[model samples]
Target chain A: MKQPIGIFDSGVGGLTVYKAIKRAFPAENIIYFGDTARVPYGPKSENTIIEYSIQNARFLLQKDIKILVVACNTSSAVALQELEKLTDIPIIGVIKPGSKLATDSTHNNHIGVIGTEGTIRSEAYNKAIKSILPEAEIFSCACPLFVPLVEEGWLNHPVSRIVAEEYLNFFKDKEIDTLVLGCTHYPLLKSLIDEIMEHKVKLIDSADAIALHLKTLLPVESSTEPVMDRFYVSDNEAKFSQIAEYILGVQPTPIKRVRLYESWFE
Target chain B: MKQPIGIFDSGVGGLTVYKAIKRAFPAENIIYFGDTARVPYGPKSENTIIEYSIQNARFLLQKDIKILVVACNTSSAVALQELEKLTDIPIIGVIKPGSKLATDSTHNNHIGVIGTEGTIRSEAYNKAIKSILPEAEIFSCACPLFVPLVEEGWLNHPVSRIVAEEYLNFFKDKEIDTLVLGCTHYPLLKSLIDEIMEHKVKLIDSADAIALHLKTLLPVESSTEPVMDRFYVSDNEAKFSQIAEYILGVQPTPIKRVRLYESWFE
Candidate 1:
């Protein structure tokens, strides 16, 4: 039995990571769980995030998964270390791959990072980039509105452009050649962000980078079997299904509503 | 011993409700809990909101309260029925008082309601308005971005104006003489919303309405005592403290961080 790869995020944003993995390995069975009930982990405390991350990992682990992907930047920044101790399976977080890519893309060693407040506060991207290029000047800003805007499906809306400009204009004077789309929901705003930055900055999308990183660590077993990815969320499935369609441009696999642990009421 | 009034919201937006209660009965001791960890219950499903509302009420009930205020519009819209069954204490929700005030303020029986997706979708305000004025014309719009924009501290920013126009423009032709600030957080945007409606719409803030309704039901026990309100949150205190100060225009009482229930890990 080929154990499937497990991916989890606070919400649907992780579907971007799922899409990349699917493209990279077409036949691999996959399980995706979105903690939609307690989402936007961006503004939550470190301890709370760690606890939620552990619960999410435990939920996915029960399915006998081969590998785990921490698709959420906030979780990757703060919970990745704790998650490593939780399980022995190869755990991949978006931070490291994203950092390496940002460093590789920046010719001037000046890079800007934008994400949720929790992720930016964690300084995971800052440290990761500095570790590779000690002299790298990393400018980080917390774009809290970006997630809601994307979730609101205002991807290319004029207001999104205004919000992107409000958040990304900080990079203009910094002369950063590369900017890391530090949150999973951020890539959906790539075009707007690109327009704001005048297409001068190379946007580091961790999805493809994570896919590349995962391929080396776990070689895909050549399989002719068709892909059947499982989707689950802690809260409403309708919103998730609708957003998933908007993001992936196709109706997602039937999504199951789940409780991370025993129902609190029960 | 005077039993304190227990008030709870999904997050700090409920502070507006707390302010109203405080002003109405300066001597009444009050307990306010912001479920910051699992906040913005606006986008969550009905079942999840009900479960969370129950947990919040349970947290407040342990304090031996005289009355309970479901300060969050989403909770009041969906969870008030369940909350009443949980406790016999006189329970007050922002919806009915707000509806009553909106109905009274409108001469033409035309009213508009703006709130989070969950609250607007529940149509509590619409139902409440119609119950009083069957001939009333109601217009409701889910202003999901309003909460994030407020939390981002863009209360009167140009971006807020643009976003307000985007959401409220739907009601332009509806000719609503009164608009219910359906979500608790909305009062923060009252000025901007007023401008978008060209000040023609009378904004009905549920906080003041809820205060008046509470007065008739639970008469204030006249006593001269300094107010020492207890504030608690399920997650980080820093963000809540800062935002509370911004909303209330005074340093909030020292806030305690707590888990609504037994820790899932423990």
Candidate 2:
């Protein structure tokens, strides 16, 4: 397939996944849709999330994407199955890759998962880890502020370190050897988290794993042409550009602003 | 005198002021606009914020508001002056009232202010306080997590308490006699903050101060009638209703969804 892969997230956090995909498959064009207008889907109802997920998938499909990546943990937890059913293209979510990494990296059979409240409440990571290593003890905490901190570009601030210390203190006594960065945004705070854990805990970044998975799924004869990444947001392009620049280490391509209600998917 | 008062916030956080205004001036109708569709304005740039603030003001002015309140601290700090120029109505920002309270309530003259990054970076409260009491010692910290936590309705959760403790501990050794809850959302975390401070620090809620200021500005004849409150939002009425019910202790009136860009202020 010569078309780009469609990646969607609730907000800019998915840029983490987009960067990983670009790194792993340099020739594969990428189309990213960040529903920035109504983001933080973590606390929204399942039905509303499913509707949003479907809308996101529809928007991606309109861009002639060969595959779909639900880069948001909240949507992946509650809306992935429905998304798969609604779309014909190969669909991937962050949960499976993260779970596998956690299961493989744990030396003590104890794993810790940290994500948004919706992701933690869904127990999706727990279920995914258990399916692979049924006896693995999974402890999950919802660090809701992590996403906003990353969005605000405060990834390495002293306050970020303080927040990491307070949240990670729970895993210190739990003997968990592997910690899953259940949300893509969590990976941006990896340095702070690692410093707090003193390099003793292995942090699993789902974005890297998902990118690896995409490499295997692509057809052998997939287009070798240089890829182009396009960014679209519902509102505030300049702010999005600033954060995107911080996360991706480069200013993203000109972000096109589109009204959600008027947007149509193929 | 016949026009309603207009208030705008990034999200539901400003409902605190909306509620307070309703209670303080019974006859003065309110028109509240919450940009829930694209919230957390604290992280956006000054230009983008000014554009959004103007758009919000235009939306409310189309509803014939006599005055405008920049209830979101971030917008007030970064875009209030720009908004004032865009509209002819009397404009009020929460920062001035908030700083006055911080200066007046402090016994030791060592006061602390906590808010979103945009607000703190603008130093609006610090400037406002210094303008009044040049000798008062002011300490400011940005508690960026408080807004998202309040939006998630995690007011009294143990984790919320832990986060509050982590954020508030910065003020513990500073011996500040008064603390300004610089963001409207911070007031919702008062119980947890009070618990963390153990009643040693008095908290200044800008919403209350703004309400009193609005009362003083209201026409005497307008105060005789019963108040009517109207709500407006950019998106997700149901989610807004759920959060408003929790924070306001009553169900919000049916919200009117407005296309802010197309609305004419004049």
Candidate 3:
């Protein structure tokens, strides 16, 4: 269990999840893969999503990670079940942990989920929440612009505030007590999202939820040296590093650009 | 010359180009492919962009197209030269046609180019403009949100106006007379963009430019029956059709989902 934890996302948005995991287990080394080349898995078909997820998993397994964290909400939503069947290793996805926390925290039994179009369309959050609290009412919206806005480093820009208001207008009348930040890139906008949703709705950041769950399972192991994290991306290392620094406040070192060989998808 | 004209884009953005081409050559059949799965080529690296473009070209060549149309700005920027080497058929890219039109349309010799990060970063329009007008001044910005905004079908949404204002504020101080919509997707936002630019700056849509260029090169042949069109995508046909309908005002017919067979990448 001393091996580094493997985390994968469609793009740099997953770096937020990696940062959370690192903070929770300071001494555990983590390996992160951002598929920057073929990102925005939100609009793609299910077969393509599953194929890329499988290929991503295979790439991380070759790195000998102890556990696989599907940090991407779209991937976790569409490919997690099939991915879980790949190995005996504890393969965890953000949807379940976040869904569980939302259900547990909600007093009104109404939860709001916001993610990429593919995530909302897949009804992953809806299904996960229904499985836990069968009687719970759920509201979901696809906020596709949020990812690009975060990538543009416009987290607090005036335009972002306007976009936030328009997208969250759906939840205003739903009487929801908890709102799930369904996309990994979303937690970066927590303050903005929280402000728009007002003080009543508890924000359920999947990154934080997943990090806490991992900590409980893999209690901090003693390490003599500081934990060193390895970074890998399918494309654009510089852009990835720049965005990583913007979101994580720390630039990942020794970043490597690795190809998810096409044959792996076959 | 009777072979169906082949056109490909990173995604539905190319449908704009397809529509423009069909309008120019009403008697010529067309074959179009949208790589919806691995789209937004605007954020990828040069090597990855070239690789995917080559694979896409290979995939379309298998269908025996007469000429190849690199309808994607990012691909045309990074891979056009290599793509030209692959076949004897005249391979044309939007950059040259659009650049030529921009240079011809400019009154002050100052031009503004707007596109994805990859396209702007590559300086395709800058080079194309400079190649013809060595002293042409170029200002470029990457409007990453426009694609998602259009895909969300928020054509005239209030938030879209705000995002446009933020992205286009760069041109306020510059004395640019011509604006190049470098990415194919930008054409869909033409009306909003026109309103924001104060109706003073001439907007150069690369799709229309490319369409006009193709007409001059591939003159319409006389035909008795109406030309038939076909569409293909690497992923989700339904979403592609939805977005295509939003932009094209008509759903493209006989759409099919085709795989870019892994071997094509090799």
Candidate 4:
């Protein structure tokens, strides 16, 4: 029960969830893996996504993790069901948490979701929102550039603002009171998106919801003392450190390189 | 006199150059290496870029290449000098050829260049153009989304067109007479870019220039039949084949997976 929670994403985007978990459950130890070598899972096929997701979960399971969180939207959209069937531990994904938040926040049953192409194309958010609200009007846009922009540490630059404006322009004339930052990377661009939406729309970040869910799922007697956070990546430690520091607003615990399949989980 | 030409890129984007070379030469054998396992070298630092570039070159050198082409713009911008200093073979990058075309095609002295943030930030094309035609006005836009869109095989799709329009809008009022498809991946979206530019601006593809340069630099022998092309990568043969086929408009020759840095060039 004292084992660390395992969090994995295609890249550092999962740090949003890691940070949220740290804030909510300060004493719980965490093991995080960002497959920086093949970070963008959104554009890949379902089979490839499943293979990568299984590898990620297996890697975390080898770390003796109590739970696994697939903190990437693309993977969640395409491989969550298969991932759940593969592992015995609870496997959480960002889509449901984000979809729930959007459905709950929408006053007029109008929700806007922005994520990578894979997530949008999968209609994961749309399906979740529709299943819950039955008649919610869902408008989804794939802001593919947001990931690279965030990775480049350009959260609020002029170009980032311009791009956010261009992508959000699709929702300008539409009536949507709530927008779900469906992709974990989108949270880093919240300020630009919020500014473009005139600060009127409520933005839902799945990280917050996932952290709350994690708190409920874990046992009450879980360790409350600060514990070490470990980071693992498939490649490029220095670049990962730079972006990780920018995204987490602090230097990451030193990142260790692990082969994708060999000796990764254990 | 019989050694094959060596080309390498971070990923399938470099296939643009491979296709051009095969078409232009027909009788010249080529050895291509795509570092699909650790791609998107554009955003990485100079040190990492040099290391990856060197590894790629070493892999190709083992194939007995007469020349080396750094098909990636990021590598050309940040690592070309290092690569040239490290190797004995005549080395070329796509930047110079693309820059030459941009300078030659521009009538109004105004040219636009679009590429990844790494390419734009390095100012490789801008410097190349300025060094050649000091009086030409240059506008550079870092289009981070274009690469991912192309990789997603969304060329000519409505979404791809919309993103292209947003990225290309900066050049519309700049009075540019020429545009350089700075990233090798950009050619995949050439039709959309050409459409958005209203056919008024000439587009320069670096791949074509590299092929021409190779033709001039390497010994030319007209064989009775076309030469066979060989492809190699660090990982994922199936995905590479699909992407290669989509980009080349023809099925890729069988690709062999090779360990990235295990080979020694004698």
Maximum-TM-score candidate: 1
Model 3: per-residue Cα lDDT over B1-266, one tens digit each: 46788999999999889888878888888999888888888878899999889888887887799989999999999999999888998898999999999989998899999998889889989999999999899999988888778777788898889889978999999989999998888887899999999999999998899998998888777788767788888888888888888878988899888763331111
Instruction: Pick out the ten consecutive residues of candidate 2 chain B with the lowest summed lDDT.
Output: B257-266
Candidate 3 local lDDT, A1-266, one digit each (tens): 36899999999989878888888888898989888888888877889899889888888888789999999999999999899888889999999999999999999899999999889999999999999999999999999889888877888999889889988998878999999999988988999999998878999998888998897779786678767788888788998888888878878898988764341111
Give the per-residue lDDT of model 4 (tens digit) for B118-221.
78989988899999999989999988777766765668667667668878989878999899998888888888899999999899998988887777776667
- Give the Cα-based TM-score of candidate 2 against the true structure: 0.71
Candidate 4: stretches off by over 4 Å: A220-226, A259-266, B1-7, B29-38, B45-70, B74-209, B226-266
Pairwise DockQ winner, candidates 1 and 4: 1
Candidate 2 lDDT over B154-253, as tens digits, reads: 6886657766787788987899989999988898888788878898889999899898777677754545556667898776688788889987898889
lDDT of 1 by residue, B142-254 (tens): 99999999888899888899999989889978978999998888999998888888889899998999999998988777786665778988888988988898879986887
Task: Give TM-scores of the second chain, every candidate.
Answer: 0.96, 0.93, 0.94, 0.93
The docking quality of candidate 3, as DockQ, is 0.44
lDDT over C-alpha atoms for residue A110 of model 2: 91
lDDT of 1: 0.89
Q: B118 in model 2: Cα distance from truth in Å?
A: 1.1
Classify candidate 4 by CAPRI docking class.
incorrect
Give each prediction's DockQ, rounded to 2 decimals.
Answer: 0.44, 0.15, 0.44, 0.14
Ranked by TM-score, the better of candidates 1 and 3 is 1
Per-chain TM-score of chain A in candidate 2 equals: 0.93
